[model samples]
Target chain A: MSAQDLDGGSDAETDGSGEMPKPHTIRLELVDEPGQLLAALKPISDNGGNLLSIFHERGSLTPRGHIPVEVDLECPPDRFERIVEALREAGVNVIRAGAEHFGEEVMVILVGDIVDSDLSDTLHRIESSADATLQDLSLSAREGTDEASSARLRLAVRSGRVDETLSVVRDLAAEKGLHVVEPLAEGSQ
Target chain B: MSLRLAVLGAGAVGGSVLDLAGDYGHDVVAFADSSSSAVDPAGLDPSAVHDRKERDGVVGEAAPEAVFDADYDVLVEATPTTLGDAEPGFSHVERALADDRHVVLANKGPVAERYADLRALEAESEGTVQFEAAVGGAIPVLSTISDLGAPHVTAARGVLNGTANFILSRMAAEGLDYEHVLAEAQDLGVAEADPTFDVDGIDAALKFVILANVLSDGETEYALDDAEVEGIRNVPGTALDLAAEDGRTVRLIGEATADGVRVAPRLIPQGSALSVTGTQNIVQLETKHAGQLNISGRGAGGPETATAVLSDVSRLE
Candidate 1:
């Protein structure tokens, strides 16, 4: 199944006893150092989380050269939170804990010197700014950094925080000298 | 699947359990009430025992102590709700869990007020405790939360006390005062003659305390005393009318967050999930992933609660 389906649709899936064990996807940014994967999975299992699958993007690296791993696990909802807490307690970098719950999808077009402004840093800042995460992005900088090129950023925000998240994006774009085309307030101008 | 059960408190819930256990492949081996009890290694006939209680006003030849020594795989405690010290019921659960027998409780007393003690008892025994009926009657509220796990269920809010809700609903719907509605509730058997427990918010507080404890996975123990309780006694019909004028109605709400538990009459906007009317109960769980999940149903009744107790028994396997 797709990752989104597993996260949001687990309540409909039940074991033989008619009780649904929640499926959670924990996104971790692991250091390239050895034993990082083992270190991450240990906390989940120790806390009674049933591991479903682990997608270790070994070849890929974050801007910090850390490997991004997505560990899908099945547990009661309470244990899922504890497992996330436990992973954090174990000093694992949790990039995203419960991504599926972010229901509000807002796409904003940033028009400016997109590539010159350190796009990765911008994305990281936005992810850390609020209860929002970068779901997908289409950055087109073929016209070069000196000229104004636009990037389409799709953000998955926590439900009901769309307005707040859009404001954060607005402020961020204004500070970065980027013009924003917000999906929500398209009528304003 | 001939599961042996020792049932404590042959009241409404307990009696319904005995009546229904056979349908679920369970048999009541031992049964007890306040005055008397009956025990048999071979399962006791529920009809015979019930008849004895009706015909002779006592449960056969055995005494209440016989339940503790009875041979059973599971203990179902459907005792009356008790408050301070959570006596008799607490002791019964302790004995069962300490004896390595699984416990399914309809009694809210021990689970709400003495959770830590019960946890200690559970840890020392080979049994685990399940009390789905304690919180929301037949709603499967606790089981739903338990299944969702605490990580997803961030908060639990509900209209828990039926008598209080009934009184409030009538107070708002018919413009009757609390005393008048309460009297109607009493006449209809919805409110007890001594409705102090249900009307004072004690019962709802107990349920919320239990929910808080369950959400915390027993790490954070909460007692009824820990809850901030406000009953419906002080709620005037005029206040409800004023709220309705503003498109709102009041519900006796019990809420439990990580911070604490509280039971008080609160204004619910019209058509909101919390604005549930009548004697119905609604438990809304705010989840991290699943959004808000609401379960509403008849929150109290012998047969309804017995269904939860039976489900807990089946869950033991």
Candidate 2:
């Protein structure tokens, strides 16, 4: 799957300077063959994830007879997800990934020709740029897009970034000639 | 008052949950058996569904994947346990969490094998995963530890698998051999036809790994292989007799800590806490401040296990 398909770039980017690396851990199940550990590690290193530790339970086995290995690494949140996808693509069984929690919620409404204007792209952009995930959505196209349409979206965002998420939605709506209904009820425009 | 639900298995556990969910105020919107699946966005008729599945041997009209796209608040994974890769059960969880739906697991494969991956999926989505039925059947051992808090839980050890415990107990009590007791247990339906997973200690070890992960705050998780396992296949009745004469009994014990996990036969003095017999299960938690806590009850049953699955579903807000 492409970068957009996995999480739609919903993770926060740590590309800027002075950003501390996020500590991420991935537990993987590996086949009992030589170089399996190396093959799994390659994805993390290749994807710019700095390795912190590796714990390969060579003595133990999962129910499927594969060895379980835990890798601790540090990278920006988005890079972490890429490493996970890469590991999965390489046929490594990622038993677990990031320990970070997405704990904030925000609700917003978009009005105007939402259906005709590629709402999917707008949703993807908001997720990618605002570090938010779509929780629940209710779209009202009762009168059809030729006249007017609106969508209510419930989003789970990274903690303390509700305003940043709303602003991203506002910008997307402005570009699409859509009106906004803010979660805080700052008066729909 | 009514919460939407999608059930992934129509077997014993699934059937019981389907029957009891109404009492808990949950509407069964979708359901699936091994051979087929059915879904209704407006909520399915329970009696009609039961009649169809019992008489016609089918539940829903669509494939299992269709349930993911259907409207539901939580997905109850009640499929058969698939160890190693944790298949169809894992896939079901993947799709549900990806769709941002809460998950309640009755299948042991996903939670025991792919806990970390499931947690990652839960973190990314607007959902959470719970699997009280995975271990100790209806015992509620996992939740008990969680309620007491994990930090206070330094170690969790128990007789997790009922089949193994039952076989060992019979051998020790009757002074019978392992094969003889195992054959009898199989006849009684306590042991499966191929009891390697249970007799070989893999089943108990899986539960050990899960508890180890939970106690360590999901930091240190051991695989089934990581556990130092020794099944009761070769254990002699004389060993049990020997321990019995000394006021001790031999039991299959699984212990987990931050350092490691192991499942093997251990000698516990008779009348002591760990010497549970029959098909009963026990989980003893070694706490740092709250003292040691031991919870024991019926470990595995269709109705008993369903209660855990239902409890998990109710936990989802």
Candidate 3:
């Protein structure tokens, strides 16, 4: 049978030696488009990856207006890294790279004039500037105005990057005149 | 297979089930609602069952007898959970079981308040009563526990009600008090009109009763009244204060132990599984083999609960 048939069939796809392709799971933030998922999958299959399962959370929209997708695929050990690089090179926003990427999690609360300073920009800075993944976020607008609003951010960063991540958050807060309540450590007021 | 099914109630849960069952090729024979009656041989036009009065109007002709006399392979009970009163719906379940018809229960009241009577009726008729939707809206907790042999389930706990949890999470996150958050939840259709069942801990209480019965081998003698019940009515902004003070948060936890079941609001440490469980969801179960297992997902709303009921129906042989 062809590789596509084996991958698409009910039974597990096995290599020439009858060994199963090693599975890797990657989380991607894709702009909701007609063929975004198909484009993402092409890199995996073209680079010799077998599809296992995909969880495309369409109803769930990220803060960046993109859908979060968790794709599980099987590939040879050598092709795994190439597939990841290909996905990134294709302009797919890789929220997370490998299973080890979600190892370290930290939650911090940003209190102050969140709305006035543009909360979205602050979050964007935290993610891109700090090299961290925004795992989840909870925002509360008590007065429903820029003067008084707060947000709780749950971030997943690489291990040992916590301090640097906190520094970036502190810098962003300083720039926006916001207060950071770092859960792992005390922050400057 | 053109299986004939009778929808006992046309509320959010029942109506959605009818819609899906019809969509999936199941013959929804008739809709028997407490409020109204609307039955056509071609099947119920779901739009007609939107209102309770409209449902009552359509089903009035068939009334009480139609439910008992209808030829159906399965009877779905989706009425609202009533405290202590097992009437009509309970009677409906009894009749369906007596007729050897498979019964699916999305209503916790009948299972919580009248589990024993219903179980006995099922035993007498040698029929099955599936209630996966009663405990956890879509978590598969009941089915999982049953599959795991319903081991010595010592304690069951976690965020039970999504509306209450959402309000509490919002209150803790944004420093908003109970009233404001509750109003938001109501506006979002997360909280009920009366809000008593949700905010007063009764909703969690009904779920606890169902879990207790399922884990206790259908023993309905457990005193739900004895179980302590507390709500977020008096949260006092403690979660916000705690978060501000130590970066911690609070969640309304419903916990039941071998000693007794307790439903109250508890402050969970930040990053704890409980705290991480955000809006409109639930998680936490402690059993024998698994020690402590956690399952979190949507715990309310018509669509989610309806999906759960459909999943249970799909498992039928």
Candidate 4:
């Protein structure tokens, strides 16, 4: 399809009377199977969503072993929810429906050998495993003792999935012999 | 109504029970340490008995087993909590029930490890078992559950250990590491010489386990092994720093529900009701009708736990 044809394919959007198309970010978890990425993208374009970027993290598998895909698209404000619904109906795992509905925010602390355990790898695994976004992290590895290292992670997890995200963090911590101090007040604010 | 009492053990709790029983309109007919016993058909003088114990290290002239011979109305079991079979303490409660006498307990072992067995014993005997002091000392956790109706109470969560709470709060307030704050807590007499039990989460876990047994209503019996316990020993000062930055703090919180029991060092909002500081403790009961009931106070010490034991004696009336 030509760029001009793609731009003018829908005349309803060409009219200036309707609401302007706004950019929305939807995070997805796609299986590593062939054509899975294409299958996930079809619903977006089919629903009149203008695709702007497809950030497919091919090698970084979530703890569940699924590839993380980030899609940035522009659509009318009302069509965003419907696009996500179509993705779900067509068997695509949507981690974040949009940037506005960011779900629950949880803070967890890891005590013991954090840097030695490969923090980036641990972060990647947890984000993929729990489908979370690491908003911020504070690490304290005292200059002396090898055992006194710790890092506190701030993550924004999908709605109602705080427990599931915690379970994944625990799994990774267990493997690395790192102690996890989980948040008790998950949805309590 | 005044009741005759037989106090067991020579620990702080038992001594407090002996010293304060009269004020609560109760008479101590028998008092026993692990190896010795003091018995009188009439009420015993607590001051004289305590003086003898302080000077001679023995409370009485009789054998410890002779406490059963006293004509007492309630057996106040204030022995140290032991795991596994919860022996001696369990045997004492069993013998008291077998004799058709009510038992008030401060020891956690019998209730946490052998809830079903204790309930079964209470069923077969003429007396019922009440163990208010075995959980949050002076907090009336079990009595509150009984008042709320066990079926109506959905869950119980709290910071059940004083020593652990003291260390965590001190670390947060001072930005001190775990070892540093723990040493200070030990010097302050907040934590015991062998801090393993309290800091390792066993003490908290046991309390929640007992809560589970009581809240489950005999459908499921829980012991220390059934709990998923994690201690505060591994909590570094940096961890607390991170929490403080987020307007939160770390606490060793234990939760008991119909599902089960768990105790761990968890992050909680600093100003939340469950975020009790120093040696203070709190129990949050999630009730079906009342929402969340937050009960906070001194969770341990002879005087504090004595109130709970005496309250149990009053309940038997």
Candidate 5:
């Protein structure tokens, strides 16, 4: 694999106030050696990027015997390019960068005759209508005395688009005579 | 400041208020059922009036209209909730305000359906109106909003209905289906025999509508139809199971903001402030400077709701 870019981010301007740091996912090719992952991340921290998460593809190697490391970091729009360049200057194999959108996970439950209503078509319509990717789905049918069934959909929605995506789900659910259980996502006390 | 009270409507709330009024240092001078009234210039014995209501099916020899003529300081309206014009309750408030006497309410109809009219009636009278029991019974939701000066409170939401909360919490906890749990709730008296008003989300919506009306502070007025309501009847056990698998629970949550009011079954984190169990009710007030305040307690019961009614009566001058 020549390290294709994982979904590209919107890279919206933050008015140069420099207060908001957009999240970005970066994939790097690292040799299977001790201290190699650390060596790849030093450039990110040095370039003022706050590391959100680091996923090391342990035991999974490319044909070149190099491990693929995924890093989720946040930095101002102006600093992302310099961070990628700095990583390349430090001899780190930068596979992909410049995804500036923050990723948010939203889960909603749809209840009704999910199978009879064409579940595949519903999922397709949701993904096709909203700017979201249906990451996972679980369904329960023909249980208990009631004929009603439920399906829980895990959707990966980009930040600031959550409300829009939820409305899309709600509209679809209404069209199919299904019920949608949304989350009160405001942080609770 | 002890108050002379004329209690109306002989339901559990009115009975509890009559039973507990003396304990709160207020005298029940006049009491009325739907068809009868007991009036005395000095005071009336709570147990004697209750016994008369229980045995003879009438509080006293006086007619129901006789309560209006009593020289009571406040009229406590505890009538059954009626929609649209919210009659009887609305008229009761109007009559009290017209008499230039304070009015305290345990009925949600007048406030939820005719909020602006209630305020307008209060504005014209020397006396004012207070209804703490109408929202979250015994939880003091409206009092908290007024204490925080409604303007400071940005929004209000919570599990306002006891029957719906009971059914949802029971289903989630026991993994039983909706019908099964609702049957159990009805058997346990947690839900009413019909269960339509409570389970269909109308009850909770009324409370949130009241919250929106109060939080708006005369900027706008809200009624029941303004809310977007979804009930817990459609939520199956499997949905709660899926939520529990993710460490979250499904609650019949209602929200009221300046934007609008919505009541639906929402997924909330388990054991959070809003995830109250059984018939417990919670009210979460979002403030401008202060953070979210969680007031959770017995949302409904005779004495519980009566306690709220008594507090409202005490607060009145």
Candidate 6:
């Protein structure tokens, strides 16, 4: 449970812990700043996690004008929770967590004046309220703010949690006067 | 007629080089990889090559020293691109060239990231590094440009990354999201385990650097940060829908003009070479005399990229 227990073992080999560390993929939203990625990585290292790789989408933009970062790391089960907590404490917006956690992915389209509807807030709400992670998103505004625009969202949710996510999405759409086009069910094929 | 060659880093591209060289009756001096245990001095047994075939024999042990001691005419660099580390794969190339061995490179990291330094080294040693396989796999973009009188390329752009294009194509065609399409690409092995290079525009940027170097009349270096890069990761499905509505398609384009060079995902009109469907790569070069020249073909994969290396070797001879 202590920090020393985590880094004591060699990177290639495991420490005295009986359990092997599991690999977890964490997606984060980071503001564009010098050493932002390194800043985000400090928590992972502090909690005894070994980095596998970093997928920093530099050109990518989130609602908060931040970059999307995807990190894969390996840590013991006990330290995994601490890593997450440390990341949160460090003010990192942990967008998604764990590899097996994102079991089902769904794509939904929303057609409306997305820009006028406070799109950023809407996306933040959907992610939090639906218990879903926004894996990817695309938006098209042909005529600018006054005209109709559509945004496509790729959401990853816990298995069997699609209904709740969809419900929240529907509620958000209704509130913002947007039309939601959901994909076909998994069993439809 | 036997060309003795040693390839450093037997990854997807390197393995293909070995296969093609072996097919053409070339004497493969040795296969050196990151793991030393995997070094095969008599050239890898054809079947042993087949066993580690998935990664193109890149995963096994690498023998960094074998490259220096091996008696080979050519060294092919197939290692990954490491930023700030000038000696990614071509460090082996440097050693081989220092030993007066020619180098054929499929790895762009060294060339794009360290063009000046490597070029200086190549000049000092008076050795040649032919990289016909660097820019466009089997497209002959580099050879064509060089042979076609080094046309005054005013502007250049293309759908560089096959994996990104494949993902975009699926997204446009099936209305699938990025994750679904990317997963499909990964399952098909068209993408790297760490797809950052492909998705984040580094791969395309590397190609642009090569193009700039080959096309430029003067010696100039393009900084990685200078290029305008936009990956398809943030490209929403709605953009594709819009493009579909507008009779256009989205393609990640790396373009250079007289004024500046830019690389980003842009929506181009459908039926254009850049918007060509599938995993094919299409490059449109605007030269002073030739006007607009379009070259299209398979960008990457074992067979296609291997053929590119063979073309370089043939040119060297």
- Per-candidate TM-scores read 0.63, 0.61, 0.60, 0.82, 0.82, 0.61
Model 5 backbone overlap count:
0
Q: lDDT tens digits, residues B230-287, model 1?
A: 7877566555655565566667788898879978776566677767777899888889
Judged by whole-model lDDT over C-alpha atoms, candidate 2 comes out at 0.77
What does candidate 6 score on TM?
A: 0.61
Give the TM-score of chain B in candidate 4. Answer: 0.98
Best by lDDT: 4
Better of 1 and 3 by lDDT: 1
lDDT of 5 by residue, B83-153 (tens): 88999899999999999999999899999999999999999999889989998899999988888999999
How big is the positional error of residue A104 in model 2, measured in Å on the Cα after superposition? Answer: 55
lDDT of 4 by residue, B149-228 (tens): 99999999999999999999988898777788888888898888899999999999999999999899888999999999
Candidate achieving higher DockQ, 3 or 4: 4
Predicted structure 4, TM vs. truth: 0.82
Candidate numbers sorted by lDDT from highest down: 4, 5, 1, 2, 6, 3
Better of 2 and 5 by TM-score: 5
Ordering by DockQ = 5, 4, 6, 3, 1, 2
Model 3 Cα lDDT, one tens digit per residue, B102-158: 888898878877777777788888668999888778788887777767556656777
Cα lDDT of model 6 by residue, B1-317, tens digit: 67777777667787777777878777666776676424455665645655764555443454567566766778877776666554656577788778888888888877777777778888878569888788888898887777666556666677788888888888899977777788888998878677888888878878887777667644566646557676777665666786676466667777765545566666566775567777888887777786678898998876788788887877767
What clash pairs does model 5 have? Answer: none
DockQ of each: 0.01, 0.01, 0.02, 0.34, 0.39, 0.03
Compose the digit string of candidate 6's lDDT tens values, residues A1-189.
221233343332222244555556788999888988999999999889999888899997998898998887777667888898999999999988754553576667676777678766677788768866665556775442233567767676755688889889989999988766554331111
lDDT of 1 by residue, A1-189 (tens): 221232343422211123345556778999999988999999999999998888899999999989998887777655777888999999999998764642456666566666567666667677678656655555443222233455666676655678888778778877887655444221001
Writing each residue's lDDT as its tens digit, candidate 2 over B1-317 gives 57899998888888888888888888888888887777888877778888988888888567767777788999999999888889989988988888888999888888778778878888999888998998898998878888889988898887899999999889878867777888999999999999999998888988888888788787765567677787766455545654565466667788887668878766566766777889999888888887778888988888889889888887775
